[model samples]
Target: MKSVAHVYPWDIIGDPGAVQRILDLGVDAVALAASYHTVRAATPLHPEHRLVDARHAALYVPVREQAWGGRRLTPAEPSWVDGPDSYGQARDALKAAGLPVYAWTVLTHSSRLGDLAPEVVVRNAFGDRYPYALCTAQPEVVEYALTLVREIVEQGQPDGVVLEACGPLGFFHGGHHEKTEGGDWGKVRQALLSICFCTACAARCTEAGIEVDTLRAQVRNAVDAGEPDSVESALGAELASALAAVRTSVVAQLRALLVGEVRELAPQARVIVHASADPWATGPFATAAPELGVEVDAVVAMCWPGPEASIPGIEALRKLAPGTRIAGYVLALPPKPIEAAAMRAELAALAAAGVQEFHLYHAGLASGARLAVVREALDSLGQRP
Candidate 1:
């Protein structure tokens, strides 16, 4: 199995030794964050780099023009952009080190864009807008994402592209020190709340013969009542099934568009999607359905440890997309604790379960000891390359 590491561009800029540090980890490829949402962070190497800390920000590489031949996506100079040319610099450095660079592109989770264009953001059944989650139902958002893919490929020139949040992100964001209390917001309720009711989504449902109004009311009632019934069952089984299928189709259509665009723009670069094991694609990827038959080089299953872990996801994707490769995204920090033995075990398990590549999460955020643990694990397992 190929071993890969995920790194933020700032991680490379903040530390002079970042490239060598990652190379020492024995990873074959580096999945660099190309487009990202707002974030606050403190870099281990460059403590002075105070661009994204305590404040949510999007890490966007400035492009000269939009790939779709539309108006340039100029984000007010400082709203969404982080550093100019950082992606190119970091990518070149990694490639020079003989490490393959895959642009780890985050597609929809962007508070910056959502804030700039509230109309394009996802709205719940109650018309409550989620400023952090950009709705894919919006053509403007889709255009922006296509432009991002083209620019990242044309500018950064990555060997591959790892698409994350390629669809609508769910409501449960990892806000700092989050705290909430209420009746059990189980999977069913969360799923109900996750259904997008934006103008475009409603139109799509209507086109698919779904009663948009009735579906919205049912979802609102389900959330308000805090009940745990299958979202489809509550919405009437046939209608629910149709609506769910509609959502899946919506995502599949978008994925196909973007994938086709990538092929046309950068046919040489491999496409890898971070997707759920669930065929419906309802967890993190509320709209994305890899099973929609979009051709990807690999499907990534985020198999971080726990109840919602990746082993099941790997198993599912292995069955669903048997022809494509399965890459396991593993956590290398706290809770998982960057330990050699643990890392080795996880790597071995994923490989045994049909994972062809292991993408280590955040080499930039990990401590030196953690990186060392990764190196030891990779070395001991002989997973180099």
Candidate 2:
């Protein structure tokens, strides 16, 4: 189906006018980033506006701590988000939307720097705090990460689930190992890595006779101290494989745990991966993803570099998961606001890509006039009958 996936704008989520507001535009499915619970979370631009109390069909959830927060999402505390009641409301709202709400969780990213819960923190070579990626290698972490997903499935039984990353959600490979998919040290030093130097991970590696410490040191020296060849000849394949294994297993467990639950509840549920779609994308992820609930339906990749980026991205998606739906997560669409000439150009390029669904990244920062512009954009996208 030809639909526009607009990012749930902050305006819509936080306002009473949200429902009909986007309807005024013509877009159907919205990714609605942020705004996971009973209300919408405030953004820097609109601080006073607490999350609006609304009924939505599709909702996005954040399960980690980056700019979003600094803790694991749970039925209590920071993770509870508005309250566990919010989870139920979230699902109900999505049902109202006649859409499914997927928990866009980041499994590996843990925010606490040091001495955090063993199940949550990712370690470094120096035994420092690279507390980002949860050591999926550990059974505890696998069980822990699925806490919210299980809740969502059992309690909310929403529609489907999407992913932010196989690991964390920030500049993914932005700075440390930005171009390259990250190694143990790169991950650990970024203070956001998901390696587990804990006895558990080492033990597993040792059983395989893999010198966990030596490999860890190689990664650590390269990442922590900026050692050259830190990445070069640094056994990226092995490290990547290990990390991927951790992530894969974590997802696999999640699938093992949730798949049945989902099928029992919403038999036709879809599992989408929210990850980057790149060509030179290095690291163990490509090989490792299938380990997680392997039956992923689609991936949501954004259009930051514009339409040209979409071309390669779509190509990458085809390679990664053929027949998997590609939700082109675009930003800055007009009508509901967030528009620009650059966006227009990028959109033109995306139209050229083999995109089936155009998922606008969000719905926010809009006025009636802007929403009007969004309507125009949609009509332009698919000659609205």
Candidate 3:
């Protein structure tokens, strides 16, 4: 099995010992952020500033005018980092230290772009807009994602690429000072709320033989009537199936186009997608049902929910996409105890469930004690092949 550590560009740009620290952790590669969304990240061990407030989604590399070509949804360059090419500088430094780097590209989860162009963001059933969730059903959003991928691959020049949020984001915006928990919206209601009703999505659903107005009404009624057991239960099987088909197709097309662009530009680079087997899942780990039929080198499942929940998901994905590598996106930070034995146990359980790779989350944010636990756990797992 292979292990990859996740880090932000800010973690490496000014910190001289950052690469060495990562090397000591015994990870095979680093998934360095090429484009990222808003966050106030904690650099617990950096020699420079300890906190980095990346106020918005921005590209770590230079936002070349020629590359964007006057697109209204162009990415902004991060002001927190010192250099014009933070990604490039970090990539070169990590490479110099003999660690392979993968350009970790975030696709459609940009609040900055969504705020600038509300027409491209997801609008839920009740006509409420989710500024953080970019609806991939729009042509402009698709074009923007393709351009982002092209710039990352062409500029960063990494050994591989890891694509995140490769499809439409849904209602869950974690960092928006969320305050909807009092509504007691269960899983079913949350899923219903995630259903996009934007013009493009409506047109696509119409093309799929779904009545948009009636479907939207049913969605609203379902939410109002309290949570059902599942999405299919709330919206009848026929309607749910149609909606799922349309949403899956939207994600598949966007994924295909982006992957195709990567292939054409850098055929040698390996492509790994953050994906889920569930047809209704959205956000960063988008739905990558077998029916979508796009090929990628690896698929990573979010494993932060622990082994009981995550192992089964990993198994489902394995059966769905046979012959492709399956990775567990394991968390190494808070809420998880700073203990190597516990971490190693979870990693072993995932591996037993057929996980061929491990993607450790937030190397840049974890404290030294937590990182030591990560290093020890990885050491217990033995060397990567």
Global lDDT of each model?
0.73, 0.47, 0.90
Candidate 1 global CA lDDT score: 0.73
Candidate 3 Cα misplacement greater than 4 A, ranges: none
Q: Candidate 2, residue 378: CA error in Å?
A: 2.7
Over 1-385, each residue of candidate 3 has an lDDT whose tens digit, in order, gives 8999999998998889999899999999999999999989999889988899999999987899998967999999999998789999999999999999999999888888888999889999899998888889999999888989999999999889999999988877554778999999987788889999999999999999999999999999999998799999888999998899899888999889988888889899889999999888888999987553777889999999889989888888888788888988999998999999999999999898888889999899999999999999888889433
Which ten contiguous residues of candidate 3 have the minimum total lDDT?
Answer: 168-177
Q: Is candidate 1 or candidate 3 better by lDDT?
A: 3
Runs of candidate 2 exceeding 4 Å displacement: 1-14, 32-74, 77-84, 87-119, 166-196, 224-232, 236-261, 276-293, 333-341, 365-374, 383-385
Per-model TM against the reference: 0.90, 0.67, 0.98
Q: Which tens-of-lDDT digit does each residue in 1-385 have in candidate 2?
A: 3444433334433345455555555564444333222223333233346344433222233333332244333322233235424444434554475644554444444443112554444455667534344455556555544554554555445456554434322224322224544444343344323344666667767766577767776665556455334232444666655644553443445445544544556667666655443311222132224422355666655555466645775666656666667666665433223454445455557766766656554545444445555566676666243
Best by TM-score: 3
Candidate 3 residue 115 C-alpha distance from true site, Å: 1.2
Question: Tens digit of lDDT per residue, candidate 1, span 114-211?
Answer: 77778877788888787777778788888877777777777777888888877786556633465633546776776676788888889989999888
